[model samples]
Target: MYYGWNIVGVGMVFQAISFGFTIYIFTFWAEAWMTEFNVGRTQITATFMIFNVAMGLVSPIAGRILDAFSIRVLIISGATCLTVGFLLISFANAMWQIITVYATLISVGSVLAGPLAAQTLAAKWFSARRGLAIGWGSTGTSIGGLLMPPFAIYLLLNLGWRQAHQVIAFLIVLIIVPLVWKIIRNTPQEKGVEPEAPARFEPTQESGGQAVQWTTIKVLRSRNFWIPIIAFLPALAAFSTVQANLSLITADIGISQQKTALLMSIIAGSMIVGKLFFGGMADRWDQRLLYWIAASIMGFGILLLMSQPNYTLMVFISVLLGLAAGGFLPLLGAIVGGRFGPEAFGQVFGLLGPFLTLSAFAPMLGGWLRDTTGSYDSIFQIILVALIPAMVSMAFMKRQAPATQASG
Candidate 1:
């Protein structure tokens, strides 16, 4: 067993905690916040926009730091911010305080500790099995999604939302800080092992050599960079819209809170299968084809949602949605890693962050549309239409090529 697997395990745990406690469990908390603050759904959803925008704004800097500095130090700093931010949120007396904490510490911390860091680490450690490695590591988010919402609801029911935040903070301190310090290494060379590829180890301009460091301007100008960003944006926007509003959507349709949580877990459970399946296949299949499949499934799921199906039908829809959602992260990681090489992985991924902030608005839009139309149907229809361009643009995404070397 290679030491890189250990790094993957740590990343899995990191994503589970970061995404589970914050993104997956947020809607549950949103319900409580609405009652406590006397605010509307759109206002609560704005926290997600602020959090996402903050993460996007900080990602490029974080990416450069990851490439040039120590990942262990960066992760530890992020853990500190995440723990402290959650602790502060427990004491927030006003909506502005929650917004401020989310926009600053929480958002910044998530970028440092979340998928960007985890996928970069995986990309660095494995060459041949990059997709599988990323898929396995990214499963932590689905696992977190599967488990966190129910646990959060239990805590929300028993301890109140404030105490729940405190518990989440404690878990972060107990789990992420020590594991990252003890287990994570920057690359395979640091652990005295070769990357999982043929043993030739000969340096080349294309294979296992010093990768060309892409400048920010060059990365932005490349069609390779922009194509994936454009291809995946709508799917991501739709997923974010659904996750952020799942609770309210269920309530609007008169589903019980318990069942709603179960639905969320079902979506997450299905995602685990999707991630493993799509991830393992990415190494062998055309990545663009896999993405189109996932996008199509997602579109069909959204179409089902517009029909206002019964609970049984909704369960079926959740499975479709989960499978599609599950495929996105691993594919994105694999695509970026494949195209850019590990040396430029962090920087390229970081530069791509702000564009993802666009997805954050999907939730706000969902909330506004629901509030204005008194139905979620319009948002679902809009998301379904959004998928058309995503799939079509994906057709134009060229296959991966050797990373271009930077000029002196």
Candidate 2:
């Protein structure tokens, strides 16, 4: 068995536990914590806003730190913060404490073990199969989404949100920290394993004859850097808004809360297929085409939900949107890895952190539009329109080659 594939396997576990206990479980905790803290609707939702902001703001720093330090260091530190954050949040006396601790510690922890770190780890192990490895690792998000919510809800119902968090923290400390320490190697070279290609040993040259290793300034100045940042920004905003308002919009359409919850499960289930299909196909097909197609499909799903309003189309919409949602990050990572090579992937991908700020605000905009117009119609229309430019970006964006390759 390839050691790289082992990293991919362990990475999947870490990602699953990381996302499950933190972000995915937050959905369940939101109302529970709100009631306990006596927070208003806006204040309770602000925790997510804070979380997104923290995740986004800390992203590049996490990337740079990961590049500078050993992978184990970041993983351990992140896990520690997450564990502490969870433990502390469980005992929090005020809403501000939850907001403050989560805003700082959990956000940092998430960046350390979240999608970027997982993809960066997987990216280090394989080049020929980078997409698949990333895709495989990414299925953790779906897996977590599929399993964790129900479990979290059960805990919330039976033991309470605080106790539920303590339980999750215990499992994370017992399970996640050790797996990361034992199984995750920063790069294959730690085990004397060679990469899939030769250039990983030497800096690859970009089109302008610049070394393609990491430098914050060089990446910030590149077209590839900006394209993905810009591309993912609105797409994520729309997606974030959709997920944030999933229950409200469904209720407005007269779908029962039970049905909406089931549909969310369907959406979660579909992500596995979406991630596997898009992730696997990327290695064999045109990634750009897949990226655009997924986004376009998302537009269709958004339209279908708003237009139909009935639960009849709910399952199909969930499936389509689920696939699109699942495929998104894998595609984004694949596109980055392909265009820029793997050397600076963390840095390049880290640049995407700031856009998450927009993602946090997107739901607010959607809600405002919904309230103002007395329907989600405008929100749907705006999101659909947002996809058009995003598709154009993928269609027109070039896979930047190393300068030597460019000259040839």
Candidate 3:
């Protein structure tokens, strides 16, 4: 078997630990923080905003480091930061300490070890199979989501939140640090293997024969760079809004806490299916069409939420949202790789990081809308309207040429 598959496997594990701890298990931790700190919902939401903003600010630097440095070094450093940050969080006595840690260490760690790194690794190792490779790797996030919450809840119940953080920190040391150190290589060439697609040795005008190095100014000036970002922003924002507020949203509709937890698992489970299915399709299908399909599903899902459906109907709605959310990361990675090419993949992806800060506001906005209007209906409506321009922008995006296709 090719070592690239090993890279993908390690990437999957990296995503599982990074996203499981940072994203999936966040709401559970937030609940504990609220009780421990005696804070309001909005205050809890602010920490999440801080986490994202910090990640956004650091992403470009992380991306450049991924491009220029060893993947092993970056990932191991991130794991150490996460282990230390979580351990510190367990000892935090005030909300300020939690905010500071989240904004600094956790935020930086997540960028280095999370989706951006995993996707960039896949991009480096596979060209023709980039979508499928990324699809498989990105599944770590959904898998983490499916497994971590129940485990964390159990820890939070039996041991206490502090001990739970300690256990998670220990697991990172045992798992992520060793796996990345042993298996990850900066590129396929490092393993004495060729990438899945034909290697480009001749310089093109766009990229000078070496790895395409995109300057910040060049990336910012390109319309191709911004099109996918604009097209997917709304869907990402909606997913963030739902993930951050799902607990509160379900409680408002009279769903039990247990059922809300199950809904999160359902979303995660369905995301696995979405990532694999849409990921395979991206290599064969028009990516813009896939975006349209995802956007439509997202719109319908939000409409279902507006109705405040019962738990039974909410299960179905969760599948719709999960499938759409699942497709977002892999598709975006494939699109970025397709447009920018593997040579410049890291810088381009990193450059795109700041745009993520826009989605960071979705959670805060959702919370504010709920507090002001006494319901989440207005936010759902706003998200639905936001999808219109995304879909339209996707329509205008130029299709990838045969040579530049991910399959190529």
Candidate 4:
């Protein structure tokens, strides 16, 4: 039991660092990249769009690799690619160079071993505790969000964005590679253990075949598979937009960059708390209720963000929004595992990846809207509208048994 949590913990750390750089820090880096590369804000934000396109386009390939390769191999490869992408971005001169390194390479690295890989690994290790386990692994993301922004801000100030990239490159090489190589196992049976559960939710396959035999095509046909992806679309849009634009949004209201970074750090910090509390809540409460309540909080927070432009309000709204948005990360995974069971979690979850990644377009859209219309108010209103559908969809999730209940 202890070892299982340890395994999940290590995987979560790997996820935290990898995704922190990929999604969260890109906002901080965007302003610096604009200055360094002599590009406009839109141009720099465009790079993030490429990153999204890459993640959406390449997820199936990532799924295939996850199914085919050892988790360690994929993780190490991902870490290496991530490290190199950061280094390459540090030295990039032309727009295409930035696109190649930051957009294409880093996107591939993240999808290869991002949250999907980590949570799926944790899912295999615990049957009855699957929601809690996936929730715990997902918290690593919030932890990274909490921790990375301040670090990135400080690093950018002290070392320049280029050197910060180098620092991250070195860290990934030193940390993730060795830990993943040592800690992750492909499956429990490999360690001379029986299945975590025998005929608990679903029977152990005759020969321990791939988790889901259904192809991506087959999985796409199932509403249960697609509904969460659709429902999550607005949340991802809100997250992606806010991540890229929050600092700029605050700056427009006369808040300094340093204060903006601090506000983001506070928001990210709240996310860590939110993840832990909500994750525990998943164990005890109906996930559907928790999701609706969380979404409502986020929607209101975004509405608050739209209304206020001052430092005081930014700080207050930041923490509130953080807590509201943070729970969705783990809750989405729990919903997936609960709805589908773990028999083919890797594939089903992978199928959901592209849609989630594509939702990141919200930020790029926000940036373009800001560039065009000169305010973030409209984007927030659109997000408020978008979120209503998402909350309603949560109610539509079939009243099927939670996966844990099925096993019980």
Q: Candidate 4 residues 350-379, lDDT tens each?
A: 777777877777887787788899998888
**Local distance difference test values of all predictions, in order:** 0.85, 0.79, 0.85, 0.76
| Ranking of models by lDDT | 1, 3, 2, 4
List the candidates' TM-scores in order. Answer: 0.92, 0.94, 0.94, 0.88
Superposition TM-score, candidate 2 onto the true structure: 0.94
Q: Which ten residues in a row are the worst by lDDT in model 1?
A: 198-207
Model 2 scores a C-alpha lDDT of 0.79
1-408 per-residue lDDT for model 3 (tens digits): 878999888888888898898877877777788889999866777888888889988988988888888978999899999999999999999999999999998998898998889888998888777888889999998888877777888989999999999999999878999899888998878877766754222111232224445687877887878987888888899998998888889999999988987898899998999999888778778889888998899899999998869999999999999999999888888888777777677888888889967898988889889999999999888899989998999877766643422332
lDDT: the better of candidates 1 and 4: 1
Question: 203-286, model 1: which lDDT tens digit per residue?
Answer: 124555454557888788777798888888889988878877887888888899789878888899999988988888888798
Using lDDT as the yardstick, the better of models 1 and 2 is: 1
What's the CA error at residue 290 for candidate 4, in Å?
A: 1.6
Q: Clash pairs of candidate 1?
A: none
The sequence of per-residue lDDT tens digits that candidate 2 reaches over residues 82-185 is 88899999999899999998899899988887788889887778877888888898998778887888898888889988888798888877877788888887
